[model samples]
Target chain A: MTTAQPLIQARGLVKRFSGFTAVNAIDVAVRAGEAFGFLGPNGAGKSSTMRMIGCVSPPSGGELRILGMDPVRDGPAIRARLGVCPQLDTLDPELTVRENLITYARYFGIPRRVARLRAAELLDFVQLSERADSKVEPLSGGMKRRLTIARALVNEPEIVLLDEPTTGLDPQARHLVWERLFQLKQQGVTLVLTTHYMDEAEQLCDRLVVMDGGRIVAEGSPRVLIEQHSTREVVELRFAGESQEPFVSKLEQLGERVEVLPDRILLYVPDGDAAVVEVTALGLHPLNVLVRRSGLEDVFLHLTGRTLID
Target chain B: MTQLAARRARPGPARVPALAVLQYHLVGYRRTWRGGALSSFLLPTLTVLGFGVGVGAYIDQGVDGVSYLEWIVGGLLASTALQVAIAESTWPVYSSLQWTKIYFAQHAAPLRVADIVAGQLAFVLLRVLTSAAVFLLVTGVLGALRSPWAVLALPVAALLGLAVAAPTFAYAATASSDSWLALLFRFAVIPMTLFAGVFFPVESLPVGLRWLAYATPLWHAVDLSRAATLGTAPVWSVTGHLLYLAAWAAGGWLLAHRALRRRLVV
Candidate 1:
């Protein structure tokens, strides 16, 4: 097969559940060996779109092609080549950690001997070799998540789909998972992940689409998106005795645009220090001040008027 | 793309492996031994001991020329086999469809839904045959088999059980929930057991009730088993009884295959 064709392509995709539209018309194309991400808030149709690409749920309308084949007509055949890690771990609780990988490999028609060898290698890769024989019910949450990722790789799939890979984890566990994902990326495996964390998107994805209300409001690399939707630096200000209403009028001349949040007001400017000096010259007594570089969180909040963390 | 299409098109007759279905039934049997085996053996033993000795002193051996103990033994063997087949076919089949998801696991492979239903029926057939063997041996100790033909009745009784169980499995697979199946057992199984001549002769019923016995699958099973044991069936030949059971088995199997394919594959 030629490398010119993309591994996944969707044109004007639409998905509906009952009478409610979950995912409206959207376009997406993912090429081979590229790390892509779907960045959105909760209930933003990220998982629904991932399910369509995974060939588990049929689309309501529009065209979807996976591995250059139709997703609906060739679901089983397409699923054989793609791996899926759902938001919730669906690992067989009755089986041991090693058996989980072996059984999943068998479902993809892998031979028994190869399945056993692959299970052993994946257990070591996920750093669970010593706990291979233990049942899944006794494992910690992080261990179960790692095992789910291991099961997804058992068939040696060309593309792996992960839905909210690190939604619920401590900092240490999240870093451990990110390190393993980086290793997979270095091996030239294509990855598609959905995450609400702006840092996760900035750290992992080469390019992404910011979705809100079932539509892609913006699409670009993290750096490109920040440059397009926001200034390079942002200055935050909190008033001590005065309301932000007077400061919003006084700080109008300092930056390109001003965003008034409930607690503090943000000044979008090319240089945060220059904006802070101009704000102090206006005879404003602020309780707290912070200057930092802009990120995807700023871009997300600017386009959708909704904070990603909330 | 064209090359991959050609690779998928090169196919002969698709066959599901037999061992996968064998593993499925073994897993099920390991989970529910009392429902499948223990009750099948114990229920008939209790009936034999309870009725054969407790009530045998009051009822006299009639002009048919067989003792009361011998007369009731064939009916008990047939009832035991039927009960085992019914239990395996109904709730277990419903659970596999809705709760356990074992069929989904099997169907994700090369195995089709039809292969699953066939494998389940085959497993139930084996269980019924084993239960029939044990019951027949107990009846033999009780001296219920007066002729050499009673030995051949083992396979006959098993085929009779399959006749009833296969159709019941077809009905069970179409059930939507557990409550629906509870209704089926309450309304269908209990009534069939009482009126199907399992405990007494169908002639003892009134004329209207006698016609109801003619439509039941178990009545034919009991009649054939009793005829084999005591040589008392005066109307239907052995060939006739065998043909009737064969019709229900074949028809029910086809219906089950179609129903399961429609519900699962899409």
Candidate 2:
């Protein structure tokens, strides 16, 4: 089998729920051995697209293939070669932490003896071996999340799908999960993940697509998309108790573009430090001023004009 | 088959999708089987003792030409099977669908919806058959079972379990709350078990209600079990009762498949 074929290919993929369309016609192909991401806000159809690729939900209208097989006809066969970590933790509370892994493995028809050995190794990999016998109900959220990730790998799937892997994790836990995912990428595991956190996307994804309102707004490597959509640097000026709308025109000359927010004005500039000096020379005094490099958050905002949460 | 089962790794068709998922339930059951032990065995023992001895002494001649103990043993076993099956299906199915989302996890694996449903119902049948077997043993020691054919109740109980539980699984898959399950037990389970010739003959009920008992899956099981234990002829032929139970199980399975697909597959 040649590796040139895309592991997953979709053309004009669409998903509609009753009268409302959740995912519009969009084309995407995930290559083998690459870390791909779906970056979007809450209702941007990222999860819907992920579901279709995962072979759990059928596309309403499109040509889709996974492992070169029709998902609807060969779902079980395709799923046997996939590892999926859903958005929510679906760990079995009644079973112990280790039993959760072993039991889930049995679903893939992994023999009991082999399942036990793999479960042991996976528990250790997730750093939950010490809590092997502990019931799942008592574990912390991070522990449960790690166990869920470990559970997905029991079959040694060709492609792993993770849906918002660290949405509600603490910063430390988030870093731990990201580190584990990066190691998987290093090991040549094909990964397709969805996240609203730009840092998560930047840390894990080799290339990603930004989705907004059921459509792909931009697609490229994180660096490429950032360069394409947002300025290299940004200047923020916060004024006290004002809409910052009145100062929009006053700072227009300091940067290529000026965007106003509820409490601050942003000057999209090539160089933030240079823009700050020009702002001061222009006689624009604000309560607080800060300068920073533009990132994926800026790219998302520039393309959609709405914050990730909203 | 025995060698294949003994071996730890038997791939291919040996790993039937239903069997794979059933194996999961068995593993989980090992940790919590104690929680159900008391009710599974003790309740059957006590019910047989109390009703067979305590209530039977008051009546000089038992109904249907047999002692009350022999007469009720079949009904008791059938109803226990019904209760075991329904009890297993309700809360567990609801929790897996809505709370733990176990079905979604399983559906993500290589198992199909039919396999998951069949595997769960198989677990229910296991509980039903084992509990009914224990009751049969207790009644046999007590000399309440008169014929060797009484062992046939074991299979009858299993059939009853699937017939009722498959439909209950469909209901539980989409039920929003345990209160709905509670309402099912209160309005359906209690009334059906009570009136389906478990406590008394359905012939004594009014004309309209007699048909209700005949229509219930539990009554079919009770009739078959009661016939075997009393060494008497059943209300219908042996094939007739089995066919009816088979129909319920098949129909329930179709509904369950539809509900599971709707709920699990987005």
Candidate 3:
């Protein structure tokens, strides 16, 4: 092992359930203090890959390591140092919010006195100190997610795995979860998360792998991936008198690439204003025009041939 | 050798888990006290009053020559023990697996599947033992105890409860849906209660149905308790009955562990 070896490493990791393959020979490596993300659509094997890294599910065949130890052989020891927030909320409803933290700490063999102090601190860190005595069932979605995060941190884990940390929450709830995750990232905790939301991946992940059909299609920093796959600017034009098809051929020569949507046409050009002026000179009467910088969503669409939301 | 030494340095399996499971039982017992206490006390109480007092007023004590109240008290204790075991083992176990997700929460920690099963069985056995103790005390207050041999009935009832609870827990863990549990209560528990000689002697039933009584754990428990309480020996050896219950408990525990390990670990 090298001195700069990654905290987590998997080589040709394959996980299959019966005849169905969930993760098909994927290789991944995550270093310390780096926020990594797995961006994919549903059933794209993101959660399965996270579970294997969390040491909860054994890989069907792979060379997997966590904290420089084998996951299959040293799961308990590796789990002791790693925190996992699963895709679903598995908080104990029977326990109070504080008790949930303490009970989880106990699972890692943390002493009761230390666990209590840690629970109090973590509750405060999650901004849930006011509701520490409340049962988990009555808490809102955001509070439950925060408590799950707090529970994962009880052992002072070196690496925290969050699977779709803000999938179903409202905007406010998602922002709160994102802010807390940002703080963890600032504290130098190695965060590995999976999210289908491109904005979430861009905001939270320093490096990410876009997965589809049980394989990694692209991997890099969000900005690097976007720059590599998509142009800097895109111009959108909608026609009034004719369908978008007629304008696609007319606009194709003005930009490096032209993509036709059902209602609008996109011209991916180095300069948005020049593309818009060139489009207006074509004598095509358009209903609307828009120019914006390219984003991770555009990169995802370009690679996957489908929008993230669709 | 180093690994063995490290293993030995850790606490015994029985110590920390016993405390955790004990705490879990206390919480569960508090939650279900209203329903659990009523069912445990009411069924035996009603049977003693309805059959032992009401029906006993009409007929003389038969071949065994024990008072009707005294005779039925042993059966009541035995059946109550079985009921407590069945209640703890079936729906609660199923709910823990499916709805409550309590077992998953527990297993996420240092607690192994064996710890969970052991804790659950231990809690159920404790509940049955406590209920049996209370029932036996009430039976004594009602002057149902004919001899000191009645004292042996408490442990016997607990063992009988384990005999039923252990295997039932194994079955409950393997069930993927709640409908199977409904069937168990409907076809198994209800029929066993009615025909297991709880309210009356099984010998009075037709020979064809008598075999069904013999098949039930409660019947063997009741026969053993009745023999102990009335000082009349049973047809089967007490060792045989104890061994039969032990076999069921052991087999059930093994099966439950296997099923739970397969489900949770994979």
Global lDDT of each model? 0.77, 0.88, 0.81
Per-residue lDDT of candidate 3, residues B118-219 (tens digit) = 878888888899899878777777787787898889889889988899889988999988788788888888888789887777788999899988878888
TM-score of chain B of 3: 0.87
Instruction: Point out the higher-scoring one by TM-score: 1 or 3.
Output: 3
Report the lDDT of model 1 for residue A291.
99
Candidate 2 retains true contacts at a fraction of 0.56
TM-score, cand. 2 = 0.96
Chain A: TM-score in each candidate?
Answer: 0.95, 0.96, 0.93
Tens digit of lDDT per residue, candidate 2, span A1-310? 7799999998999999998889999888899999999999999999999888877898999889998999999888888889999999999998899888887887887777877878888888888999999999999888888999999888878899999999899999988889888988999999999999999998899999999988998999999998988899999899766478878888987787777778788889999998888888888788999999888988987888744445
Question: Quick one: best lDDT, which candidate?
Answer: 2
- Superpose all Cα atoms of candidate 3 onto the true structure and report the RMSD in Å to 1 decimal: 4.5
Clashes of each: 0, 0, 0
- The C-alpha TM-scores of every prediction are 0.74, 0.96, 0.89
Q: What are the runs in model 3 whose C-alpha is more than 4 Å off?
A: A1-3, A238-243, A260-264, A306-310, B1-22, B31-35, B38-43, B206-208
lDDT of 3: 0.81
Clashing pairs in 3: none
lDDT of 1 by residue, B121-159 (tens): 888887888888878777777666776667666777788
**Just chain B of model 1: what TM-score?**
0.86
